[model samples]
Target: MKKGIDWRYRISNKEAMMGVVLAILNFIWWYAFAYGLGSRPVKDYTYILGFPAWFFYSCILGFIVFTILVWIMVKYFFTEVPFDVDEYKKEETE
Candidate 1:
């Protein structure tokens, strides 16, 4: 440990778990609209301009929603914790 110097900012395992969960959620969400829902109701959905509901628009919207969720989690829960360098040093010395 050094005075006026902080050794921190280690990535949390919980963050990794969260990322995995989000990825899975994205996969499920996208898959539901793309395939799970099948090829019927999606085709019936009215288009705004010309593109169909099952086109790139849905994909983009899903990505935007996913991004917002991840951003919220990062902004709220992500944090830096101080690491004990001396503890590691002592273990290495042993």
Candidate 2:
């Protein structure tokens, strides 16, 4: 007899893909701020809280934004799956 793909695996794959998408978005955010603002000459640079504008946006703000994004993703998109072998066995039998 052949067994079908497990439900837990599907959930895990979906979550993993979501994580990858988040990571890509984070990289894009960092890249945009780091390169878009930082490419200017030092004399033209602006400061925020004594930090360079690029540094403030790319590092500091990026951290806070991604932290919130991850929190929201986990709270809303992620599922609570049982990792216990017994739970799997019971589901398979059912």
Candidate 3:
């Protein structure tokens, strides 16, 4: 018989781990812009084209790059694989 609680169909630990790694990498890249590459807060221009200078110029590039990276991760890493349930299921297939 099935147990009182079945938590299957939930994201596995591996998926969670990969997501955490992806988030960490994204944060690291953002931090690099803030510190490693020395990106300072813009205070001069109000807007470039139609958006704020900081939003249109400084962060726009990072946003594009990060978006691409995240897209790649989602496309390749976050795949739906069958979870191992041999331990939970019985040999009789009950």
Candidate 4:
């Protein structure tokens, strides 16, 4: 703790938990699409925008979902704390 410093930032437990949940969701989605579906033998399957089924679901769609999640969290869950350095103020006054 330094005098006259007016900066403080910390991640709360709720924020951390939110991040963990999102990460797990991403992992599961990737696993299901890339490993589970992609591993299947090539059959009369279809592709999205020329991308393989696995890549489309695991990467493209997952990217969209992840972006939305991040946007929502940042918009509503984020907190900005205000900091005031009283010691610095008194020093300047004197």
> How accurate locally, in lDDT, is each candidate?
0.70, 0.95, 0.63, 0.79
Report how far off residue 9 is in candidate 1 (Å): 11
Model 2: which residue pairs collide? none
lDDT of 4 by residue, 1-94 (tens): 4665443433555677888998999999999999877887778456889988898999999999999999999899976543456764665579
Separately for all candidates shown, the number of backbone clashes (residues 3 or more apart, or on different chains) is: 0, 0, 0, 0
Clashing pairs in 3: none
Scanning candidate 3 in windows of ten residues, the lowest lDDT window is 36-45
Candidate 1 off by > 4 Å: 1-11, 41-45, 81-94
Instruction: Give lDDT tens digits, candidate 2, residues 1-94.
Output: 2367678898999999999999999999999999999999999999999999999999999999999999999999999999999998987789
The worst-scoring run of ten residues by lDDT in candidate 1 lies at 1-10
lDDT of 1 at 77: 79
User: Cα lDDT for residue 32, model 2?
Assistant: 99
Tell me the TM-score of each prediction against the true structure. 0.62, 0.92, 0.47, 0.70
Per-candidate Cα RMSD to the true structure, in Å, reads: 7.6, 2.0, 6.8, 5.6
TM-score of model 1 vs. true structure? 0.62
- Cα lDDT, model 1, residue 3: 58
Model 2 lDDT, residue 42, Cα: 100
TM-score of 2: 0.92
By the lDDT metric, which is better: model 3 or model 4?
A: 4
